[model samples]
Structure formats: structure tokens, C-alpha cells
Target: MFQNPSNEAIASILKNAKTIAVVGLSDDPSRESYAVSAEMQRRGYKIIPVNPNVQEVLGERAVASLADLPEPVDIVNIFRRSEALPDVVREAVNTSAPVIWAQQGIYNEEAADIARAHGKTMVMDRCIMVMHSLFVRGA
Candidate 1:
């Protein structure tokens, strides 16, 4: 089992990443993806919604996959289940995203190892919104 990233590292990653591709993001605000993406956007990172089911989310145009994004994304924030993590992590690593963040309750050691081996930072089962607050600090 992989432990979640330290607060300092998570804060630094969130602070430096300007563009976040939120995989599995939903249109519903009650959803975890929606809440995290909303907070990321509020904190000034461009939130790119990646979900085939939604055409748009959080007032921004949504892409079906990270591969479909217009340009390179700094972070690939995954909101999918453990079973769906492999493909998303593969795509994220292939895209050369600097960071791959698996949301709370989601974990895949194989996928995380693959990402890390590819020189990408992997943060599993951590909330980006919480980390963002640590970095932004009183903002």
C-alpha cells in the first residue's frame, strides 16, 4: 500500500501546477470531482474537465479524455475508481503530465508505480482542494 504524499510536497505540487486535467469530473456539484475542480478553479488553476459523459462542467468546456486536451496539462487529477486507474494513469504518463493525483479513496499501486517510473509525480488518495489551501495559506 502506498502512503499519501506529505503535506509540503502536495502543497508545492498544487502551488506550481497551473493547469489541472480533472479526469472523471462530473457535472453535479455534489460529486467529489465537481467540488475539487471548483476549488482548484477558485484557487486560479485552470480546471479542464475530462469525462465522456459531460459536454461541459463547472462552466468550462469538457474533453472526453486527457489526450483530447488542447495543450499539455501540469496535473492529471483522477476521480475514477481503482479499477479504472490503469488506463487514466497510462494516458497521463504518455501525455508527460508532471503530476498524477488520485483523489481520496482511489488507489492503484501498479498505476502509481508506472507513473512514477515515467518521471511523473504520483499522489494517491489525497484531496487537491485541501492541499491547495495549504499552499495558498490565508488567501
Candidate 2:
């Protein structure tokens, strides 16, 4: 099993992260991923939506995959099931993103291992918005 990141580490990641590639982000606002990524954008972080099916999200052009991102990224925020993380990790490694964040209720030790192997910070089963609120915005 993968342990969640420490509060301090999460706070640091949220503090420094400026570009977040949100994988599996849906167009529907009802989805947790959409809501969280949108909030991140509201905080001035650039949100790159990574969903093959979506052309755009939050007024930004969406990339089909992490590998398709035009610029280097600070964080790869994953919203898929645990079963999908391994592939996402592989793709994220290609970008050399500093952090791999699996949203609340999602965890994959295999993907975490892959991220750690590449020296990327791995956070599982935590909501980025919640962490940012508690740490940066101090809600």
C-alpha cells in the first residue's frame, strides 16, 4: 500500500505548483475532477486538461494525453481509477513532471513506485484543492 504524502510536503507542492495537467478531467462540472481543476485555475495555476475525449475545458485547450502537453509541467493530477494510474504514470514520467497526484479515493502503489523511481513526488488519495485550501489559501 502507498502512504499519503505528509501535510508539509503537500503544502510545499501546492505552494510551488503552477501548471497542473489534470488527467481524465471531464467536461461535466458535476465531476470532482472538473471542479477541483477549475478551482486550481481560479488560483492562477494553469490547468491543462488531459482527456482524449474533450477538446477544451475551463476555456483552455485540452490535450489528449500528458505526453501531448506543449510545455513542461509542475504537477500531473490524476482523476482516473487506480487501474489506470500505471499508464498515466508512464506518460507523466515522459514529461518529467515533479509531482504525480492521484486525487482523493485513488491510490496505486505501482504507479507511486514508478513516480518515486523517477524522483517525482507522489501523492495518493488526497484532494489537491483541499490541500491547497488548507495549506496555501488557509481555509
Candidate 3:
């Protein structure tokens, strides 16, 4: 379920991924998580907002954590601080998401290593929306 995506593989993931669970999602439209999730939703991907404080986002019910998601998630996009990486990685492992995407400016070598060790597709310090536009969506 998990494998490192080469440029071509990344292209494939973007082409086929149907759902994304966005951790650290915020109600504030200005937040990076919200913006990216909104973009992805507009692009036709289901964006599940994972956050404790928010009850809803983008008209969808918000999940408090990844583990609480009722269905399989193809990708887990994280917007948390780097210091929180380990716990997030553990959750990603538990959730069995095929891809774990650490948003732009968010990176932790230890977490990336753990994710890779678990055979997860890990994309650190990158923006999925940007990558999708550049490599697949042709924005």
C-alpha cells in the first residue's frame, strides 16, 4: 500500500488518489490547510478535515483525528508543526494511508524515516496542490 513515488509515481498518485485527510485543518480560510484542502476539493478530491476544535469545514463534518475516519483514506496531508511529527507519523501508520504528505515547510527526518520504514509513500516538505498542478493537473 505504501511505496516511495518517483516523479512518474507521484504523477500516478495524483492522478488516482480519491480522498485526502487533512490534519491540522482550520476553519479559517486563510490557513494553509484550509486553502490546500479547498483547492483539492475543488479539483474533485474528497477532503476530510481532521481537527479537534472545528466541528465542520467546507460543509463537511470534521474528524478529530486520523484514526477516527470511518473509511479508508488514500492520503494523509499534515499541517502540524515539525515537533509533532512523531505522533502524527504513528497515526499515519495506524491509519494505513497509502501516502503521507507533509505540507510545505513541514519536515522531520525522523518522522519521514518512520513512515518509510512502515512502507508508506512519504512526501515531505512539499505542497500536494502545487505538485498536482505542476505534474498532473496542469494548472
Candidate 4:
């Protein structure tokens, strides 16, 4: 059985995190990924878009992959489908980012295990924007 971290732990991560690499972030403003990432950006977190299909999103240049990031990020926020989590987690674990967060409706035990095994903080099936609003902004 897999469980998400406590609210306190989540708050801590949100508080300390300054940079987030949003995997699968779409260029289209209508997308959930774009909306969420935009909100996070408005809240002062640096948004790094990681989408091979787009050249840019929210004014930041999109990277083809996580490995393409010029610098280490604090969190690797994933917006990919549930079935793709394992592969994405595998890539995230290799990065310097300490946190691997899968957005709402995305969850995989294998992915969680891989992230945990790598000593990365794993957040599955949770909305980053909602969590930030709750834990950070106290909304």
C-alpha cells in the first residue's frame, strides 16, 4: 500500500521549493498543466516546462527532457498519464531534484517505489496547485 506524505511534510516541501520542472506541461493555456503551472509561477516558483512538443510555455523555454535542464530543480512535477508514471519517475530519480510530484489522477505504486528508493520525496495523485494553496497559501 502506498500513502502520501503528511500535510506538514507537504507544507515543508512547498515552503522550501523554489524551482519546479513541470513535465508534460502544454503550450496551450486551456490545458490543466498550463493552468496549474501558471498558478504556481504566479506564486513565485520558477517554472521549467519539460515538453518535447512545445518550444515554450509560460514564457520559459521548454526542455525535451528532464535531463536537458540546465540546472537542478527542487521538484519534478509530472502531468503525464498514470501509465507513464514509471518511466517518468525513472527519469526523475536521476535528476538532482529532491521531490517527484505526480499531479491529480496520476498514480503508480511502481513509480512511487522507484522514487522512494532513490531517496526522493514522492507525491502521487495530488494536485500541486491545490497543495500549494492549502499548505503554502493557507487557502
Best by lDDT: 4
Per residue, candidate 4 scores C-alpha lDDT tens digits across 5-106 of 999999999999999999999999999999999999999999999999999899999999998998889999999999999999999999999999999999
Which ranges in model 1 have alpha carbons more than 4 Å from their true place?
A: 1-3
Q: Write the per-residue lDDT of candidate 1 for residues 108-127, one digit (tens) a residue.
A: 98997888789888998778
Ranking by lDDT: 4, 2, 3, 1
lDDT of 2 by residue, 37-119 (tens): 98999999999999999999999899998879988889999999999889999888889588999998888889999988888
User: What's the CA RMSD of model 2 in angstroms?
Assistant: 1.2
TM-score against truth, every candidate: 0.91, 0.95, 0.93, 0.98
Alpha-carbon RMSD, each predicted model: 1.6, 1.2, 2.7, 0.8
Model 3, residue 89: C-alpha shift (Å): 0.8
- Pick the winner on TM-score between candidates 2 and 4: 4
lDDT, candidates in the order shown: 0.85, 0.89, 0.87, 0.95
Tens-digit lDDT track of model 3 for 1-139? 3234687888888888998999999999988888889999999999889999999999889999988997898999999998898789889988858889888888888888888888888887789999999988773
With candidate 1 superimposed using the best TM-score fit, by how many Å does residue 33's alpha carbon deviate from the native? 0.9
Off by over 4 Å in 4: none
Q: Name model 2 segments beyond 4 Å from true.
A: none
